[model samples]
Target: MSMLGVAAVIGVTIATFTTCGVGLAHGTGTWCALPLVWFIGFPLAITNALIVGLPLAFLFCKLRLTRWWQFAVTGFICATPVWMELAEPFTSVRWAQFGLYDSLNCFGSGLAGGLAYWWISQKVGIRRGTDEIAP
Candidate 1:
């Protein structure tokens, strides 16, 4: 359950971030590749998500912070600085093309990830015992 939840969350997060990037590029009059870029990027981002998010999740688990808020806050905070780093290489004009929406996208993605995590865990019956007699 938790595993699926994490997978879904990471899936959505990567999609959202990559879309945001493409959208920003397009908004700024850049030659943004839509379908082609998504085709290439999603898999790579998913790999990164598993590689990175899993360890971070494990750490959160160790800290007894596996709840939604914990994941949400952790994901948001962790993601925001990365956004800043992404902005660093771009010119001020291009960076300004995104502005607050970039941060919002990150926050929304984190929130969605957290909710998906919690929701999947609930739906998958992982916390429920297997010993109950079937009616």
Candidate 2:
């Protein structure tokens, strides 16, 4: 696999660990939920990659949207209520139970996730075709 791809996986894994770890701590779950968090994280990450990450990728590729503010705003908007709303039905959770803060938490998490990805991509370099741009 490409180094960029590997870095994405590693970066997302770390982000998931920290985000979910803290989320479970604050949410209506226990340490016993850790396994489930990990279980849910990877798939949810794929959902985020598709639902949130894709547009960002498009902007990055087509529009060359590389600004930090662009990433943060785009990531927050896509990942906050939108990702949750879209992905919720696929998950077992009832939408009625979610409050405003849940979205805020998701926004924060998505913001961090995007930053994590950007930082990792910067460190590992971004791939465009078979060649990569060195950091």
Candidate 3:
């Protein structure tokens, strides 16, 4: 859970920097945008992690699918609903307004977050059976 939160922070940070880079390059006051983005993005990422990521993680562990790619794919999949909400494809008429760029942002967040969670879990020695004594 905590690792997921860390991942969320990482994802939000990456997406914010990427999205704000143009303004930053132009010397605009985009630095303030990070907090706002984090405010929105962090909760959303955490919610997704809890609502979607936890189940997927449990499934993966049960299935012995703990590979890095599997976690990455899980992250990408988990981020999909959030992307859909942000994109508003069904509610909006011209959905192209928030298309590829937004997608890349959200998906990138998911990927980064997922990988981060996996890395953190590994570093913390939280793998299945790691805590069990050898028979």
For every candidate in turn, the CA RMSD to the true structure comes to: 6.4, 6.4, 4.2
Candidate No. with top lDDT: 3
Cand. 3 Cα-lDDT: 0.74
Q: Residue 15 in model 2: shift from native, Å? A: 7.5
lDDT of 1 by residue, 1-135 (tens): 346345544645564666567666668553334454346434443444465566876665455454666666655554554456545756676567665555555455555555565556557653422334355
lDDT, candidate 3, 1-135, per-residue tens:
777778877876776677667545656443434666757888999998988888877776666565677777788888999988888755564444435456667888898888887777788865653344456
- Output the TM-score of candidate 2: 0.54
- The TM-scores, one per candidate, come to 0.56, 0.54, 0.76
- Which residue pairs in candidate 3 collide? none
How well is each residue in 91-122 modelled by candidate 2, as lDDT tens digits?
44544444433444456556665666566666
How much lDDT does each candidate structure score?
0.53, 0.54, 0.74
Candidate that scores best on TM-score: 3
